[model samples]
Target: MNYKPTLIFGRISIAISLLLIVSLLFIDCNSDRLADIKETEEILRKADASIQNSITQKNIDSLMSFYAEDACLLPTAEPKVEGKAAIKREWQHIFEIPDFNNKSTLTKIEISKDGSMAYTMGTYLATMQGEDGSPVEEPGKWVTVWEKQSDGHWLIVVDTYNTDIPPPDHK
Candidate 1:
């Protein structure tokens, strides 16, 4: 046997083996990442469901619980409301309105690679009684930023929403 040819073939085999191992490790890491993303997405979906349920029940306390202590609420036609207390007050005012009804449909949700943060974009339909007892509906879009807490729970850290329908009397 020619030692030169045997040595070259041995090196080639080792290189191929190393490449295969690396490829397998890369694939396994990616699979784990995908699983993490899916899990995060499910958690966010459940959270959204809780929010909807709270709104349906008009439970301001439960709804506010979804927000972080330092969360911010950017409402349309109003200044930004910062902190849990302010957000709770804002929701309380909305809940106090007679015939108030709101529904949110999540259009998209994205999670960070590290699973430390996420965001959801959705459309909202809100109905309330006007001053003359007339039913009014406002269609809008909203984006909420969520952060993973130390307790492994996700909470809304920032929320911003605006109406899609333009205001009346626009020239």
Candidate 2:
């Protein structure tokens, strides 16, 4: 047996194994960060879907449930509404409007690595039908800031929306 050559190859193999182990440890340490980011993204997606469904179903309470206590909203052609109660009132007012049919299309969703914060921007299409069944279409965009609470609940911290194009056939 060539003892010298065999011993040298064994030492090199052990060194490589040690390096690989250290590399895996580093990767494992950051795995939680990636998981946090993924969780945050999922939460935002669920909130978006909930809001869209709420709008479609005309469920005002469900629509506003994802808002934080101190959240703020900048609605089109209106003053900013702050706090959860005010936000709820705003939704109620919209829900009370006759012939309001709205749907959202999520165009983008981005989240932070810590999973503590995120923002989503998307387009909204609303059709308000007249008593005679004539539909008036409105297209707009919205951006929402979401924050993960201590209790693992995600809520909108800030919400803003604006109309990029006026309603069809408007004066």
Candidate 3:
């Protein structure tokens, strides 16, 4: 009845089935990870929007809440400021400028493959009173790094920005 050929054919079919199953499993896992990454991006987008709202409302504390306790701020024309206390002081100083106002728009928010970290690229328009007591506009781009906390909340670990305008001497 040629049972040897039938047996060999059965084994081949079983092997092919196993390979297909394994491939499908791998693809499914990757799809799940991709979905997670997309969801994380949305979370960051919402967070970015909330932080900008805090700025518009002039809520210093709310603005600071987005930062980690040991965050760092690399402000323009200054050395790096570390820790929440220092960052808060920097914000306070900026807030002190007469007629100070800022508006930020996020351009991109990229998530790490592991979904544990992310970074944001954004631009800002800031206005403050100059030495002549007239509103001075400062347009700048900023990049902020974020880490997802144990509570699933993302906080800024590093925030840095610089103006587009060149130095007076260079102008």
Q: Top TM-score: which candidate number?
A: 1
Q: Which stretches of candidate 2 lie over 4 Å from their true place?
A: 1-19, 130-134, 166-171
- Badly placed stretches (over 4 Å) of model 3 are none
- Which has the higher lDDT value, candidate number 1 or candidate number 3? 1
lDDT of 2 at 60: 78
lDDT by residue (tens digit), candidate 3, 13-126? 999999999999999999999989888889888988898888777788999999999999999999999999999899888888889889899999888888898999999999
Model 2, range 25-109, lDDT digits (tens) per residue? 9998789777777767777788799888988898878887888999999999999999999999998887876789888888888
Model 1 misplacement above 4 A: 169-171
Indicate the residue-level lDDT of 77 in model 2: 91
Q: For each candidate, what is the lDDT?
A: 0.94, 0.86, 0.92
Superior candidate under TM-score, 1 versus 3:
1
The clash count for each model shown is 0, 0, 0
**Candidate 1 vs 2: which has more TM-score:** 1
Lowest summed lDDT window (length 10), candidate 3? 162-171
TM-score preference between candidates 2 and 3, better one: 3
- Tens digit per residue, CA lDDT, model 1, 1-171: 789999999999999999999999999999999999999999999999899899989988889889999999999999999999999999989899889999999999999888899999999999999889999998999999999999999999999999988788967
